[model samples]
Target: MPLRRLLAPLGAGLLLLSAACGGGGEDGDRPEPRRPESSDPAEGAAELMADMSLEEKVGQLLVPVVQGTTAEENADLIEDHHPGGFIYFPDNLSDVEQITGLSNGLQDLATGSGAGVPLFLGVDQEQGMVSRLPVGTRFPDAMAVGATRDPEAAASLAGTTAEELTALGLNLDYAPVADVNVNPDNPVIGIRSFGSDPALVGEMMTAEARAFEEGGVVPVAKHFPGHGDTDVDSHTGLPTIDKPREEWERVDLPPFEQAVDADIDAIMTAHVFMPELDDSGEPSTLSENVITGILRGELGYDGVVSTDALNMEGVRQTHDDGEIAVRAVLAGADQLLMPPDVEAAHSAVTAAVEEGRISEERLEESVLRVLELKLERGLYDAEPADAAAASDVLGGEEHAAAARDVADASVTLLRNEGGVLPLEEGSAVRVIGSGSEEIGAALRDKGYALADSASAADTVVVGTDGARGDAEQKGLVADARASGTPVVVVAQGNPYDIAELPDLDGYLATYSSVDVSREAAARVLAGEVDPSGRLPVDIPGTDLEFGDGLSY
Candidate 1:
């Protein structure tokens, strides 16, 4: 397997290109590291690749999650393994300065100040439900954006979020979930998707992708080929999408196609299996027909492709870490994300390339895509982000205002039976459920008196985290309704919470349980703002349609 001159068209104003090199020694150890003089990404990547070891080049194809909050905890791993990047989870981070210092420290160990290849420190800051950073502007979920029916709102927040992330030394974001999310009981992607409509989801994804790129963060439009219609969570078990090719195109693939049209730098593959697309029994993450045949050949996408976390049960159900790594590369993914065992995954890939099971061209193709995106984002020349500057940007007042706007706009008035809303800011109210005290305090701040009991209140405001199935929560709603007061339910989680409890006098769907969303629910109830958010998804057991919503 020999390194050859190769070039291919990819998005981001960058070409997937690498030049033949004579720099590495015959024994395959690297020479002294150096920076590229050329500003062009292709030339710069090639110049840097010229000094890489076969070990290093293989390492470039992997992005594993590190083990701790401080850089020293994972110091030996970074110094020894040479992973192209590392993913940040909540356990691996504590604050802005901590994460920033961790990234900067790790890079200093890996790259030695402009002497070696830099690291792609990344996170999954999708804002709602999946936000990894402990402190930041907690923007509402994609479904909240979907409720507003405006792609510009999605773009604006994404750009702002990108700036904040970059300020904290992160470069890649696995976000703006492109899944359609048509399943009402979808355990994984319920509020993550924009809406059920393919075109709208496509538009939102394209808008957010552009914003992330413009903000100097690589937004990887994800769960490719779509994971929207399933009822299972891939983190726990293997899920399968049984749609045929036509239905698959009609439902799941549109957003990804739109992502490609927007020239998204990367797309992540789903762990779920699609038999119609490929009946090989392999999940899409390990299927060549799905990745190479469908995504590359049929869709004409040339950017980087990454597998979802390989440590999950979805990808791990049938294979070990080593086999999963080898199969992912053969499946056309450029990055193997978070395999259970990084060393085994790395060693297996090396062995495969050495055994000629995976050709050098295939391996180099991934390496170039990884390098091309990193170089295109100016990561090669940029310094580690200023940790002290993070406080100024993360959870800024402006970002909070923007997030509030979306949250307020996404408050869907799912029901107003007997005109219970506009509950009069002075009404005596009793709020109960998860985050109930916050909702009660919000009303109290708005001049509404807090009632000690539902029986003494003018309106009983009940908050729920998908209480449609929770018996205790349902009993609370029932007791409130039994009190003969107008029981107004604020569904702070799933919109369908009101479907089973039809006796409730009013209902509001905020689409998220984040602080912004909780505050927005109060505003809508107090009539400080009108309910503008439409339904992104329908309440399956009731009459709520895809676009159903109301105002005061």
Candidate 2:
């Protein structure tokens, strides 16, 4: 039979799959059996990919987000667009059971759609503020983890995390942020990055990728070639990377190269524009010069290329829904990450094919890659995991214990002047600062009481959550100094607030106020863990001296 004639029935089957499964390709025709003992998963995947229609293949390239309390809302979106996958957010999760149910429900929809391939479930479970699994252990932020500078530790943490995700039937974890935090004032990448050094970041990311894959999950190394330097948040607006292509090749591309070398399953494109890298006047997500020309063509990354969320203003502001989808495809992105309109994306690609803009071959190439990834991950024959099993996997005791261990190891005592730390047990300690509740609790657990005022205490712990630096922080610091109590100023978020309290007896920068961070701070205050974590970024001060904390 002619190739065109063979594709006709496949096209009809895809339509039926879309209509029956509600858009997720869940209701497509059953996958054909391979030779029993066919040893190669890729061979099976290629065979399956050959059987899909253009529409079904396109459906395999989309991953969408559905936000509602229940699976009903989630299923509606899955059925409507038949996205190749779904990314879970905090809202989609409540507890382990809820998350399991959510995953199972999605799988059920996929099975019903007749699409033999399993849907890829992805989440940004980076341990701190970005964690989506509620019941999962909340580890320290990436910066804190970086403090340890131990790839073994990072891998161990990721390995535990991956096990939990797999239990819930989620195959993909978008994490191990490879962005080097060179800019201290970086609004979005702050603390999310492992550290400011490219070598360290690359090492940690490589370790994390290996750990995740070893634990039976697909790890996505993301925000390539790097989103570390931009002060602007891509979620709200477009951020440009103004460095020359040579500079990027020297600095930013190293971590991505390391990740590729490690055989990471996916590389997510950044939303930032690097005109120096690509003068196409498009963000990296939509620029073929960046994605294909630089990343794929130059860097030799043949794995799946996923775009950062298409809904973000960085990408959406410049291109409409359909145009963004089409441009990303043209740019060599294998997957459209969270495209706003699934139907429009599908239609746009179809239109592009009809108009001879995107050749059918290109579409097939991307689809085959997607199918290969699914098969490589064992999603083909895998059944919807038991809800009970999922509950056991998410935030299980083992995972949480690992998180606490990493968090405890990350706390650094940046500066402890005049021997103010290791506060005497049973001492009268005055906790006088906003968002010091966690620190205070840690202090009290060590047999310290909150003094009525700074004057009545043997010591005062002035902690800031790094939320604001208005009159409030300054006033508290001043009052503590006036009370004659030995004050320990701890900036729990950014250390910038410490400069205001120049009169403090001691200073510490925890860099974050998350649970693990608080625990590390407590340990450091008690002189338990040596403050080995250097300042990943410079803390500004006239007399503080630049590069004061850099190890090298």
Candidate 3:
């Protein structure tokens, strides 16, 4: 047979197979089929996953940061890699309209690609220091929530947070920090944690998780196994958790167990290394003993496991970009979160599969689970949210009202002496400290006259830095002592800073710098709102130990 004749029948057979596969050619060549819109998104996802090649399957594991604000960047990521999800940062959110539009654009890109699964869009809205939606329903830190000792309040706040996040087309919240802040010097977990007690942390964790679930948002309990005891920040370097397994079982693992029991949708692994548990001295992101043995086998948590940001210095310093993704997958993580190099991650996983380091069955297990999550969240087949509706619901009047209520309820008043509080109306009051300006402005809004210097005032108000009282704080105390004015010191950081300035006439620890803390301070000073918030953690200076609260 001639060469042309021999090729003709082979080409015809190829066309028939393409037709059967629902792939048709562009300009007479076979193009991929569009993702089918189905009522049963899970079945649709399973069917689509079955058709994916090794490259596409591996691509599903890469959750890259989509750079730039345009749909073009998102479309490029989707068309090229077919990523399983998107993680939004503050930069990614300009407003409700912008975020909704961005999410719609990304979903359109995902659907246009051959993959049929809806992209899981996630954000870090844990409240206080790490909220992406700053303008949206700004609540007090987790510590403040814990101070209320009202799990119902925590759950209601979390539900309100979820309602706002979900209205903007975001389905996943990387929140409800479960770390028990045992070390007051802990650089990161400070006010972000519920409290130092594992049981209290567990109660708050369970409530927050339930609230998120009820609001139709997947809540992820994070920094797994705990990041509370370390002094170092993982963002700057790897923090080691050098404790015995028994200590971990008692102290660090309770909140996670509680969260898992509460049916939290996901668990995010911390990068801290616990040598006593893993022995390999590697961060949790790369250790099978930590992710597989402890989180899965020991704790018995069967939810989707995600890694902390792979771009962080802790994980990146130890493993190359490719190895980080591969190790996390092999370590039983269902998602490779925020890899510094997405292409390298894809290549690494593909090579690992070929080299038999990671089995196809393992890849399917993770990808299928991820797909199932997307389906369960109703991400697939749900229409893009209305722009007006998103604007109304996201950080709107209702959210602000809820935030104010939580702030009012969670504010703790730690002290009142000599009845110096309920600042005499029209009395000159000096507000001191970096946060004083903001706090003063809030007070002014309530018709209080606040002065800047102690010399001109009848009373001095100070913001204490929760850690140790530094030289600057000592200087402020000296000024307060010399002024002969009634001094009211409000420790905004942690109540622990109060030990440094015991000479003040009136001392109080609000335990947070958020609006709630400020409001609580103002109310206590004015004697309007009785300080019901007890000390969740002990004030360091007094003979009174941890968990002591005094009546005002």
Task: Put down candidate 3 lDDT per residue, 377-405, tens digits, no spaces.
Answer: 76654656456776677637777777666
**Candidate 2 structure, TM-score to reference:** 0.88
**Best by lDDT, which number?**
1
lDDT of 1 by residue, 404-498 (tens): 88888889997888888888759899888877878888888899999999879999888888787699999988888888989888887768787
- Separate clash counts for every candidate: 0, 14, 7
Per-residue lDDT tens digits for candidate 2, residues 346-422, read 78987898898998888877877787787777776665455566666663677677776776655555555677777
What C-alpha lDDT does candidate 2 achieve relative to the native structure? 0.73
Q: Which pairs clash in the backbone of model 1?
A: none
Q: How do the predictions measure up, each by TM-score?
A: 0.92, 0.88, 0.89
Q: Supply the global lDDT for candidate 1.
A: 0.82
lDDT, model 1, position 84: 84
Q: State how far residue 296 of model 3 sits from its true place (Å).
A: 1.0
